[model samples]
Target: MSFNPDILDIISLTIGALLFLMVLVLIIVFALEKEYYAVRKSLILLLFPAFFLIMPFLNFPYQDYLLLGISGLISLAFIVLVMPFNNRKKISDYTFSNKVDERDIMFSRIRLEEGTENHNAYYTDRPRNKEIDDAIKANPSLLSEGSTYYNLFQFASANASFDTVEAYHDHLYKDPAPVKKDVDAKQLSGYIKAWSKKLGAVDCGITELKDYHTYSKLGRSHNYGSDCKLDHKYAIAFTVEMNKDMMAAAPAGSTVMESAFQYLNAGSIAMQLAYFLRSLGYESLAHIDGRYEVIAPIVAKDAGLGELGRMGLLMTPKLGSRVRIGVVTTNAPLNIDKATFAPDVIDFCRICKKCADCCPGKAISHSDRKNINGDIRWQIAQEECFRYWTICGTDCGRCMAVCPYSHPNNFLHNFVRKGLRNSYLFRRFALKMDDFLYVRKPAPGSPPQWVKKNS
Candidate 1:
């Protein structure tokens, strides 16, 4: 059999052209997305494929063998990336026994005025936090003047969203109707899931309410120090996405504006769901911003929403931490979704410390997950994080913005995410590629043009 040099040349050209086109398209997308670093990196990468395209023109001995080897390697790499692998871990492995006390949370503690009865009493119980809390209090409050990124209009816009969410507090819980509607649990559950998507939710799920999911005590509002008596059997959890462009600005005023707006959107959805459940003759409560009896992340995770990422945020399959959670607890009989237990996400977080490295507050830990009161997980320094938030006048979403998983929910990134879940080798390769193309530490992107104009 005669070896066809012409055929080999044709094959090589096709491979080279495909590679070049793939990266070229990526460059165009990056540019459109305002990812300058990615575009720059892609330009440099084009040279590699260029060499392949010109390989036939260059006279070199063993060139045919080299091309054949390269073709084989490419095929093998693709197979390795797409192959299914078992790396899933159970949620029970990292479950925590300690139920959180909302009173101890930063939002709760910050609301306590110094020298007031509640403040004095709280510090008396946890004297160690007194100094730390006081230090954080010394900084300018969030969205206030003197703090970084304190734009009057943007902050006001954020406050308006927050105020609206606060209004929902009074309407969170309600009694069922006099006549209970005859309904199948499965049908109702399916209806709620489908309807929730139409109500601006990116994803929705259900889970039986667990003890640890509830806060030990109520913290915000007039219910301070009271035990959270939520006895709802089922929780409906859903996520509303944060605008990617706004979040790309991280600690900027635009980010907080988007955050607050999403919170309102989340709250609105939750309230509607709660009201609907009540009308169906089921007691229900909507847990939104400014009023939460249950921990949103834990509930969301149990509802099969997502795994807990290193930043101590709910890393949804599509949007990662770029989301606000809305949970509605009800006595309504409903079907529950199987909880998602993705060890691949955790494993990726272990290796990819971009969040930790990019944290301006130095609050996120670079160390491995530790056993904290029986829970094996990474815990951020809340005081340090809140302190930065107070000074910044924003939630400082640098961690979320830089997360590889937080990339736009599109075909290209979704393909990468699929590879990440399926194979460990692809995870390593993807991480390396992410670091190279996007840079290990990406700068905060410019705010949207509209936001800039307003500023």
Candidate 2:
């Protein structure tokens, strides 16, 4: 095909026009979202039109082919430069053995009635926590009228989902039927992964259950008296993507509604996984929503899913902390991915304390990671976080919404993530760029149009 000069001119103009339009759209969107950094970046991207326009004037034979080759080479060079600084490593030297006492968690303690055996025993063991506990008790409580942003309708709606999730707790722990025939481990794993995907899981991973994953005692529900002893040998952890539109309304009713909806989605997936394991003659238990016997984030970390971030949430490379986790504890033998701890993520969190800055309750820590129960981790003030939730009449997720890593799971963000994973230089550069594009403490955006209409 002969390359006509007019055709080349037309193509260049089209490209430039599309680029300009995209930049304009981005600027308007950012302005509405109140994202100053994004607005500035969009303005910069608008300059790409000049380069696109000049391409036609410097017309050479097979110009498109030459441009493609140059682009590829540049990308390759960028990757090569960034690869060395990626400090992802497996830390076999550090091992966690402390069994978490479930009674220590706020949820478990919230369910405790004053003067009850469980409550008395809990207070007897940790007298220092009693004063804080009493203070939390003094509040009107979640789903109560005294909350600052209380919406009785929304609170009730969320409670309905929680009630449904609680009903499935017993079914998850039930014993399975006998396996009459031999089963393929790999095939079963693939099946579970596919099934989970169909059930709305964005990612799935498996790991051998460690003693540190399960809590030492039963917290919440009627199982308060039971000792925390999970005999399961393996854990299946999965994540559900949070809706960006809904999450943009952080610390609001819409955000809580979205959170409740995802919890139900995760709970359904967990219940299904446990039931499937039971059908295969393997013992399994689903830890979903309010009825968790094990720490989901810890299991998720061991499963090679992601690292724990500053907000004390699982920071997956793809979705960051804007994901809901579901875990199924089982005895079903399966292949496990080696746990990887990305120093880059930890480093980024250190430099980018946006979550701490944007936290409404000041629950996130401003300090470095500490040795909590033998593992180096950031400890958030759970009492304060939950107290904020009760006051707001919602589980305020401001930290999750404003995180740079919590950008929508799309090509543009993933491209940035690829660079971030390959190079510490890129990680640092990206963080700075992110802060420039999205403010270090971006304001909470409005809910989607649909949500507003419904409300």
Q: Estimate each model's TM-score.
A: 0.96, 0.84
Please estimate how well model 1 matches the true structure, expressed as its whole-model Cα lDDT.
Answer: 0.90
In candidate 1, what are the lDDT values of residues 312-365, reduced to their tens digit?
999999988889999999998999999857888888898899999999999999
* Candidate 1: residue 110 Cα off by (Å): 0.7
Best by TM-score: 1
Q: Model 2 reaches what TM-score against the true structure? A: 0.84
lDDT of each: 0.90, 0.81
Off by over 4 Å in 1: 1-5, 86-92
Per-residue lDDT tens digits for candidate 2, residues 8-40, read 467676666776786787688667655566887
RMSD to truth, every model: 2.4, 5.9
Clashes of each: 0, 2
